[model samples]
Target: CFYLLFNSVLFSVLSDVELRSYRWLQTMIFTVEEINRNPVLLPNLTLGYLATDTCLSEGSTLSAALSIVTGQDKAVTEQCTKAPNVSLFPFFFCAPHLQVSYFASCACLSDRTRYPTFLRTVPSDAFQAQAMARLLRQMGWSWVGVIYGDDAYGKSGVQLLIQELEGSGVCVDYTEVIPKSHALEKIKRIVERIQSSKAQVVVTFAISPDIEVLLKEVVRQNATDRQWIATEAWSTSTHYSAWSGISLVGTLGFALRRVDIQGLGSYLTQLSPEEHTNEQLVQNVWEEVFGCKFGKEMYSGPHCTGLEKVEVQGEAYFDVMYNVYKAVYAIANAIQDIFFFLPTYIKYGQSKKLISGVKFTTPVGELVHFDNNGDPSASYDIINWHMGAEGKVEFVKVGQFDAARGPQQDFQLDLINMENRLYIIQVPVSVCSESCPPGTRKAVQKGKPVCCYDCIPCATGEISNANSRECTKCLERFWSNTDRTECIPMLVEFLSFQDIMGIILSVLSIAGATLTGTVLTAFFYHRDTPLVRGNNSELSFLLLLSLKLCFLCALAFIGRPAPWSCMLRHSLFGISFVVCLACVLSKTVVVLVAFRETLPGSNIMRYFGPAQQRAGIFVCTLVQVLICVLWLVLAPPLPTESAGGELGARVVLLCAVGSVIGFSLVLGYIGLLAAICFLLAFFARKLPDNFNEAKFITFSMLIFCAVWIAFVPAYVSSPGKYTVAVEVFAILASSYGLLLCIFAPKCYIILLKPEKNTKKSMMAK
Candidate 1:
């Protein structure tokens, strides 16, 4: 079989060192098994296998194969070239570790004149250099010392690295290129030169074989104190453990490891078993050749049963090459499809026409045909290797580079959407520091590259999401009444003792006024006889009536309940006060008239009568009613529910025009009445005993008006307790004034004058 000879040349070396790390091999094997089980497209075609010992003796067999391919002339090379129209280079598939000499040698051999069939799976050296430059630019590393292997790999890496660094605003302090094959001695020399140069950080690019040798030399030379940085390649055991005394270890290249094989086998088993005929047949052939079971020991690595028993599996040897094998098979299938189908598929039926429709699925994912200039028209994976257990290694997938997406802002591959790829377990550098900005989030989409998502701020009292358009409202305790632009200190309700005191004082004032009113009414009507027949005692009676009314009105507002209650209560009480005030005014007018008429000959005052006094009362009372009507019509009260459903609504019980009218009218009338009483008192200062009552009436009015007027401001301005006290005092003063004015003189005359009593007794005898 074509595969038998391929296997012999491929597996030139088979040992535990190569077989121990089965990750990459396992991934490849699973992919092949899946493909073999599901050969739907090529139903009749059988898959085959080949293995190689490229890792043997530092990959000498690989180098020999590359050299043979590179030694060819242009004509011979063209014969092996896959396709001229393909964008990616000559090799069908290639993976290079970027080891200084090896990479350079491989790149050199890949020249169009040398080997047209060579193609690379990893990024070109230029890409790596650009990435390094980007990292340095971000870090603000102004200068660095470059120490590299003097061979092809190191030289090429350094050139690209320098070019990228220079383009991105970094200055190389000095470059020290060392020979790749000189081993530990070369490292010592470079370390000494780097130390003398005083570079802050050293960038080294070398193969594993050379890294260990150089690290030992650097320690011996006492240059291990120097800070050193490198790409992910240096994370290998050769460089990691070998670098003895370095104070710092940091990397700038792709750094990641491990692929999750969870659930991989079960997923592949679902593929059709009949399609896996070729794989099974090949396994059977190998089993017969090796004189052991095919899948048990050959497919899986050796498992130790006892002290002397070791199960050797063929898969352990060549399974890691599954990806490579699939890549070859895919190419073969494409070639066959292109050659056989083009004849019928193409318009002119030409088999030699450019095979642009070629495509295939590989272990990694999908592989589409290339475009011109050896540039892959399909997606590519970026990966890095890290040192693992027992001197083994692991591969970490970073991100995918898709040309279909837009390029990076800095003209590099945009890793924006690739931040969440399975390869990059850690967050990407581009988004980590600045977190998708204020209006964005990490988001990925198929077909088009997903940029960060946008976060929409909420409206008033609402909260916004970090990565979405959704928003929510704030809780009641954390009220943001306005837009969520800011959060403010919340408002809370707290009833103070002072407020309650005000209300309580107000209640006492009202009760005292009511009591005074009851007393006044009782004195006026409870008696079987009239207290006054004309304006003589009319003034005293009216004054008492007015004080009682005022007290009652004050009582209405004592509680300070709802605004509506204040409005209604104030209206009713105001009207009552006005009527009582009218009575006082009428009495004052009568007194003024009586005093004027009693004067020698004042014709203008001669029209004084009880009818006139009664008429005055009616006029004043009517005017007071009109004022109350105006107040009610102009301003209405609000209900309690509007202000957040609380009993206290944000209503204006602030006694607007109505209160002003009530107070002004009552006070104005009282002032006028007091002035008239004062004038009477002054004129009748020396009159008869019954008429001396005018002086007392004047004094009582003055006290009543003054006290109540003072209470006005306290009642209107003071909020809670003091206001209540002021109101109570005002009511007491007015009530006592009225009571004294009406009965004080009469009580003195009746109780203290025994002569008048005796005289009346003698007249009766």
Candidate 2:
């Protein structure tokens, strides 16, 4: 005979609480009765039970223990053998000490040496605390506040949670112990510290009743913004069902894996006072469920009609209800195996060990089994409390945290609370500060964590796209694009013949060359005329040819730069302009000397003849040619790419002049020649010759000097291809000025107004 005592009450009770403990008792009873009726399975075995109520008191547990263990209710030496026990005080130790240590184990019944027959359906607090630790680390929450009850279970659970969260990059910011008796001031102070702390996350390991007290205090303080990590002890507890002030909306925690109990719904629906009147199990649940006495005078609400549906109360019997059903079937299966297969098994402990290998699947899909420690294998449903339609509470399945997988995976907190039209973000934020967006990096504030910081924009040529702890320097030879998130290659720019500005300059250069050709043609056609021959026709012809070459040289400065173009662009420009300048100097000298030797047939004018002027022009022009040859040999401009300059993501393709001093010398020598040409032409402007050319030469020298002077600042300020464009523009402007000012007036007289093509019209200035 299995004389079992089922306790209908718990260690404590609260208002509007779900009757989970009572449901566990009824499930065990239903399982025993169902097994006894199955003749084919256990034909000869019949199990019996004597049920009692602890009345939510330690004294009640002691009284129930004495009556079940010994026939004389006070005397307790030992039981006859191992029957069924409801003794919360397992007589193996002192009673009050056992109650104190219930939090450490299971009412201290887990000590196999002292109470080898004690067994429980509920997984102990040890495994739940370990699971809570794993959940915290998975969420990447390192700083947390812990609140615990002073009772045995809460005391031991807090210790275990701290031990588990220790080395996993998690630590407790504060630990508060709730007293066993309701100390209002102590609870209020503990909650104030929690609400005011910098940590946005907190973990609690307290009994259901203590949680209610702490939550009431929390609700009063309006501390609804923290992420609460809960354990199994109070995660599914219904003690806080009516407190609407505290939102508790996005709380994350572990919950027991639920399974559907087969036929339990049918059994609960079939309860009635008319049928099965002798069954005490039926009368006890029926009275409390409908809030009425079975035979009392007053009617509370609904009487035990027993035809009621089970769906109304079925939600309460999920997690712990399934565990109780599995425990009973395991004991039944072990008895069956002992009698039929292992006939020699007589010891109760050996038969209990056989329960380890029992496996079965209930009506629900979850498979039930046990590990060697008699605890269920670690698997928890990660849940979030979501506010649904019409402010209804819903426990949404956000993710899963399994011990079999890696420390952290399979969690998406962003999926919860999405359908609510009020909020676009899925979860309520539980961070000290919003994450820094892209293009900005985090600047850690003083005496604060990396999570709590100020956002600072990335510096020039640097980038940080996402939540960055610090701004990183851009890589060498690479620059941050317009957006700071990425680095790209710099743009290489150069002067080109095809671009808009380059095309206009190139067209001007060509037009200047054409004008010079027209002027030379007119001079050749008028070879015997006084206006053409009076100004030393040989030198005038040479100067006109040099100006044409200078105009054409401006065309070389356009288009994509390369090794060959870079080497010749500036060199050709310098040498051709110098030749034109040398020719101008020769004509200026010829004008002065011819006017000075006009008194008689003097040999002074012989020295300034056409042949002599030609020789001097050749000697002056050859000096520039020698300087260019040495410049090309020593430091020639070559094609090169320089990146990561003032402009970002653009590559500048300017031909890099190999030597700075050589480049300076080239420009400086050109300027020196123009200065000399201007001064000499200015002095000889008033020469007394009818066809004096020094006036036109003076104006052209003034224009040429002005262009190069402007080129210095424009060239230095511009970058990349534009820098080369400035120099090219200077060449075209000066060439065009010389062509327009000096040659245009003569060509107009030679072709358009042939009347003024005489020496009298030329020497009028």
Candidate 3:
């Protein structure tokens, strides 16, 4: 059996050795020899290989593939009964022959209808594109520029990348294609686009040679501040590593996972020109590594000593060499299966089928097999380029990607101390716009991608998180905090005794009650005096007592409203005012009846005597008591929270009148008694008597009626705690008016003018 190896040998006309490609060629030869020496694998079968140089040209690659199939160019190809071709080139014209490649990673090659016999040891570019899209999203790089080569590999890879970025909030601002001819002016124009782009991150989907030309211009123009994302094609290329000083210091890319093959390193270091004199590629590599000439006649340089050795400098030389080794072993395993288990006389088409089903574990313990698409299991190592000793580039493994894991668990990054190696102190920011913080939401621009947007603050009663698309309104009883990031409970307000307004109203209420007590004491002390007897001291004492009760009832309105307080405050105010008004009405009747009885044998005093006056007061007060009972039983007031009107940020704790009609009737009854008392006192104000008590009763009733009439509008218009304050003020004002108007003149006569309190002053008018 024979293995045909074809690879790009020449990169330019100057014939400089591409060390990385040369290492891949040597890896294939070493694997073929290792398999032949194994005892149990293929006992007596020996494998031979034919190496061909394509000179990195498409025409040359096609010609070399044809020569291997026809067995016309090499003696080894003619002697072999069966040969499997292994190609390192990406693009090829598919034929019926079995072609297994170590480097062809174009996504189009995975189509079984287009290339029926094509298979590869490396993963397709489809998976690499997905990985690239995920990396950009993970890093929050929403805006970026893409540059691809003009070949099938570059075009298909970038097309798949853009498709994977759909709906991910990652946009490609511009895409430039590298020319096939490597023209200087065309490459310069592409560089100009890179420099002018607003995106700080640039991604490339081209092979090493195409990228090398473009980067040369990039370094010449000194455009080195961008963060570069590389594909597997040229991530570890030594060609760029030599020239990548600070220009590509913190470059990030994906590469095939590296595995250490035992004895592979020692075999690579043992290469010399004397041992491989028959191979021209080996002699050329020897001259390049040792800086000497194999033949002094060909070039005027020092001749190689034939003992010069090659030291593997970096893993860049062996990164893709493992792929070449796996391809050779896979073909040998397929042949072993064919001879031992299958029929000896197999067709050429059957050989391709046999290789497709081959599965084996490598020496490094990695399972090697191809799937239905003729591609291996997809996996990659995230590589970061760092400046190493003497300014050389080092490939640091910072993360991993596996296709077999879950979507959320597949891509992982471990970038410990990675920021120290970057050109800047922090990870580069590559977004078109900054992210929206808390309390703000993103407003998308009219004609741009979702990533390009403006940030707007949340409304007054709303809140939002970082990068949120919309603001959420707070609940009814809640309000937004100062930063608007969260919702908090609103401030609850009520007429509490701790407040300044509540304290002032409470003190005034106490003072009025105390003054009423003082007046009641003075009347009791002088009960036998003529002035007190003439005014009917029993009615005077009862009126003063009722006024004191009215003053104390206002205290219930100046505290936190509860179910009991809400019901009691209105009931007490209604009943106390009714009793006080009944006393005033009885006194006014007594004044008019006394004047009529003195004129000429009148019977009015006989009807309105002490017993009759007490009955009249009791009947009037009983009517108010029945109204309060019905009001509390049917629909009484209760404490409730109100958040309407200007109380947007707070909740007002106040009493809600359950039935408006019930409350109106209570106030209406008090007004009816006051109207009767006022009209009777007005008629008796001109009575022929000194110390006319009717005059004081008329003024007190007028003041009481006026204060409550003004309170109606103020109570209805007030909000929150002020509504309770207005009601308390009305109660205090009316109580003080009755106390001062009716008794202030009587107290002055009894204390200051003892002579005027005698019987002579009582009968002066």
Best by lDDT: 3
Instruction: Compose the digit string of candidate 2's lDDT tens values, residues 703-723.
Output: 889888888899888776778
Could you give candidate 1's per-residue lDDT for residues 670-722 as a string of tens digits?
45655655565555554443434556656766776777667777777754334
Cα lDDT over the full model 1: 0.44
Better candidate number, 1 or 2, judged by TM-score: 2
Note the Cα lDDT for every prediction shown: 0.44, 0.64, 0.81
Q: Give the distance in Å from residue 77's predicted Cα in candidate 2 to where it truly belongs.
A: 18
RMSD for each of the candidates: 15.2, 8.7, 6.2
- Listed in order, each prediction's TM-score against the native is 0.45, 0.65, 0.78
Q: Put down candidate 3 lDDT per residue, 545-611, tens digits, no spaces.
A: 9999999999999888889998999999999999999999999988887776756655767889899
lDDT of 1 at 318: 24
From the highest TM-score down, the ranking of the candidates is: 3, 2, 1
Better of 2 and 3 by lDDT: 3
